[model samples]
Target: MEKHPRVKLHFTLTRSSWLNVIERWTGQPERNTLYHGCFTSVKDLRETIKIFIDSHNTHSAKPFRWSQAADAILASVDPARTSMILNS
Candidate 1:
């Protein structure tokens, strides 16, 4: 890590690849959307990626929303740690 002092390193927790939520979200598009489409040119590929990412961001950008279950989960905290937040 010292060899690349300027670059940031982020280590995912061992034994839980699925715990990486971004990986889970990316995997959904890779399997169901990206891999199925054939792009004719770089411009086409870029446009496709932009459209998909924009669609994802529209729904996934917020932390708490009335219609999304993921937002509800994000809004929740462990009950055991709730008291710590109050005390702090």
Candidate 2:
């Protein structure tokens, strides 16, 4: 890590809900394009991704909806522990 002074590292907990959400979102493209598909070159892969993104944006793009209410989300956290972590 010292070799790249400009790089920053972020650590997330195992089985984090936020990480799961992102994985689930990206899994669509991986399953649809990359899983059983093969590309001749990097350019081909780029074009495939571009087409997938464009089609997804045009037809199925929608804002993410939070399943939990703000208060419920906050309630799941321990306020004292959160404060301690923040202070650390």
Candidate 3:
């Protein structure tokens, strides 16, 4: 905290490695796509990775089931508040 006071820390709860779903998915893509593709130079490899990531993100499903984090937060806040918040 002292070393990087400007940087915010995000800590996920234990037993919830699934919270890092993006990284897990990325590793598989690397092994299946990038790793198998031949690259003659570092620039070639970098460009290939950039293209793959852009294409992957374009075709991938939304990160969370909910459209927005705010919506999820409001929905989970209180069952009573759900009607008011969502309708508001």
Candidate 4:
């Protein structure tokens, strides 16, 4: 960390499900295509995930955006911190 001063650290809650959408989304691919499956090479794995991603995007993917910055978003739910949400 000292050697790489430009790199900063940010921590997240271990038990927050609402903020773990990436984990949830990634699990779908693993369970749908990778689980109990065999891949002979890296190319096969990439192609499989690519196909799954393309199909999912075409049929099921929804648009997403971050309405707030990281600090504002995290502060909203953090008990130790206060944001506009807490005051309201």
> What is the alpha-carbon lDDT for the whole of candidate 4?
0.80
Clashes of 1: 0
In the range 1-88, model 1's lDDT, one tens digit per residue, is 6467596544433455446766887787778677989989999988888888898789776663456577665566344346555534
TM-score of each: 0.45, 0.51, 0.47, 0.56
Rank candidates by TM-score, best first: 4, 2, 3, 1
lDDT of 4 by residue, 1-88 (tens): 7358687555545667666788888999899999977999999999999999999999999987878999997776677344334533
Model 1 root mean square deviation, Cα atoms: 9.8
- CA-only RMSD, every prediction: 9.8, 7.6, 9.7, 9.1
**Residue-wise lDDT of candidate 3 within 1-88, one digit each (tens)?**
6367686544334455555785787796588678779889999988988877787789875665655688776666466555455544
The 0-to-1 C-alpha lDDT of every candidate, in the order given, reads 0.68, 0.78, 0.69, 0.80
Clashing pairs in 1: none
For model 2, give the 10-residue run with minimal summed lDDT. Answer: 7-16
For candidate 3, what is the lDDT? 0.69
Q: What local lDDT score does residue 70 receive in model 2, on the 0 to 100 scale?
A: 91
Which one is best on lDDT?
4
State residue 31's C-alpha deviation in candidate 1, in Å.
2.0
TM-score, candidate number 2: 0.51
